[model samples]
Target: MNEILEQALLYDFYGELLTSHQKEIYEQFILEDLSLGEIAGDAGISRQGVHDLIKRCNRTLQGYEDKLHLVEKFLAIKGKLHDINRILDEYEAAGDNAGKLVADIRKISDEIIEEL
Candidate 1:
């Protein structure tokens, strides 16, 4: 993933675990894609202050990911579901012999949710 997306996911999964200042800087940097200067100006601090805040926030976010990995697991499950849905759609469009394949895919998806 791109740095922005990766950082954003870290925040989404672990924002509640972050300090208010860390969350604020992370949200502005990752979600809003604001420049360091912009964030610093908004916070009434120097550009370097914004840069330091982002670095500290990134470390904090990464620490949570290292321990939890929840975001990664969720993404994996979502991707698998999307793949199964695509297969089901294709099978429906193909018709007849693929009916069993669609049934199999649905069964697999059920199993995936059960695993979740």
Candidate 2:
């Protein structure tokens, strides 16, 4: 996955574990695409301080993902769902056995739910 997308996923999964301040800074830096200097000016910290905080947030979020593997599992499931969608499209184009395709999709969906 792309680094920015991976970071966004990690932040989505683990951000609430961060303090409000950390979350605020992280959101500005990552999600909002703020420069460190801009964030520092808004937050009344030095540029370096903003940089360090973002780095720390990255490390903390990555650490959580490393230990829990929720992000990994989520990405895998998302990929599977995408594959399922592509297969469904193919089945539709083929114009045969729609019932079987629906059943297969349901089975895959059920297994995903069970895994969760």
Candidate 3:
């Protein structure tokens, strides 16, 4: 996965667990795409302070992901859904292969259930 996307996923899954101040700074850095200097200027902190805070937030979010695995499970289920969609599209294009496509959908659905 892309680094930014992974960071966004981690934030989405566990950001509410963070303190409001941490959330604000992290949102500025990651979601708003602000530079450290920019965040520091806005927050009235040193650039190094902004950088360290962002790093700490990253570690904290990653720790949550490590313990919960919500992000991992979400990505897996999303991929499975995408696979099922592709199979459905293929089934539409190959009308004669309806049985096979139905079986594929069933298999993916079972995997999704197991994941949950």
Q: Per-residue lDDT tens digits of candidate 1, residues 1-116?
A: 88878887888788888888778877888888888888988889999888887888889878989998998898899788878888788778877677876888788887886765
Worst 10 residues of 1 by lDDT: 94-103
The residue-by-residue lDDT of candidate 2 on 1-116, one tens digit each, is 89899889899999999999999999998899999989999999999999999899999999999999999988788778768877777777787767786778868776885765
Give the C-alpha miss distance for residue 37 in model 1, angstroms.
1.3
lDDT of each: 0.83, 0.88, 0.89
Candidate 2 residue 81 Cα shift, in angstroms, is 1.1
User: What pairs collide in candidate 3?
Assistant: none
- Candidate 3 TM-score versus the reference: 0.82
Best by TM-score: 2
Q: Candidate 3: global Cα-lDDT?
A: 0.89
Q: Write the per-residue lDDT of candidate 3 for residues 10-105, one digit (tens) a residue.
A: 999999999999999999989999999999999999999999999999999999999999999898877878787777777766876578757777
Which model scores highest in lDDT? 3
TM-score of model 1 vs. true structure: 0.78
